[model samples]
Target: MDSPEITEAMDALRRRLVPGTRTILGIAGTPGSGKSTFATWIQQQFGPGTAVVVPMDGFHLGNAVIEGTPLRRRKGAIDTFDAGGYLSLLRRLVRRDEPVVYAPEFRRTLDEPVAASIAVPADIPLVITEGNYLLADQEPWKEVRAQLDEVWFVDTPQELRLHRLVARHVSFGMDPAAAVAWAAGPDEANALLIQATRPAADRIIPWEQELE
Candidate 1:
């Protein structure tokens, strides 16, 4: 997780890629560990080759499913997402066929996710697929890691992650106290689960730079 090792991992991942690779980079980190931010940063750094990001959040079940199922209590739990759909897209994404492929995007404002938000043309050399459960040992999640060419796990301090999570929830309209409670309760519990997968990552990034 040191700086040198982190850069080396990134460099090695870059070296394996060339034009027409359609490389799938998997990034998993606990909620508030900055998975989306880091993925966006990497995409921006990837230059103009159409490197797109397909977040696992896009596969979250609709409101009805969440409300009616046990997942309603733990909205961001490991089992809350539609792992099958995510696997399906990943399987298709790794294919070497021609034509464009559209990936889904999660709409946080509506608290509902949608499929096929981005049209990923076949020419793109890299696709960043990030989420908290990519390395999860659960049935389908364990297999999810296999589809990725390179997988990096983001490791953030527990205290900082809690702070970020609380702030994030508050920004989304929750009261400050409620945000902290949720972050420390369900959110922190999820972070513990994600940290258990750290040893499985090809690279671990502590993310000490330019993050609040």
Candidate 2:
């Protein structure tokens, strides 16, 4: 499960660590591109007490807030997130002054973000965050990128990504037909947007190799 991309990233992160400061690494990719998996792998490689993961999905707006709006249909779109709040969390994580910082977690089974579900202790030196919009060029997202020490783009095949998205939705209780439709529609749109930000990444990791 090792690759030159990951090895290089690990070396880079280790070099960036200082006694009192924490380094933040971002993993960005299209939906179903395995950003979360990759981030977790990186954290595991770094070992316990040295690294932690904080996902951007936790910033997703609650269904209640989106239910009466057009965003309900486009649930995963950029506008459906609390970009400003996410930015605030990143800033707080950068401070590294608190005993422990609690971050929210998104539960796919409940389709909601649970408050203070993940804890980042001050002593942990590496923070790995993964999401679709980490490299986005949009307003608050542009600011979001500034908080990270380095950002890696997860490159995955479109066919595999789409297939994964369909399976993911189905696993979460969505109808097969609706899952396929969403994968082709809103998911594809968001994927394209994510793809556009690939050039901004510090590195591109081919996800297929990691999958194997």
**What's the lDDT for candidate 2?**
0.89
Show how many residue pairs clash in every candidate, following the order shown: 1, 0
Candidate 1 residues lying further than 4 Å off, grouped into runs, are 209-212
Estimate, for each residue in 119-204, the C-alpha lDDT of model 2 and write its tens digit: 99989988999999998887999999999989999988888888888988998999999999999999999998989999999999
Q: What TM-score should be assigned to candidate 1?
A: 0.93
Residue 174 error, candidate 2, Å: 1.0
Model 2 steric clash pairs: none
lDDT of each: 0.82, 0.89
Q: What is the lDDT of residue 154 in candidate 2?
A: 91
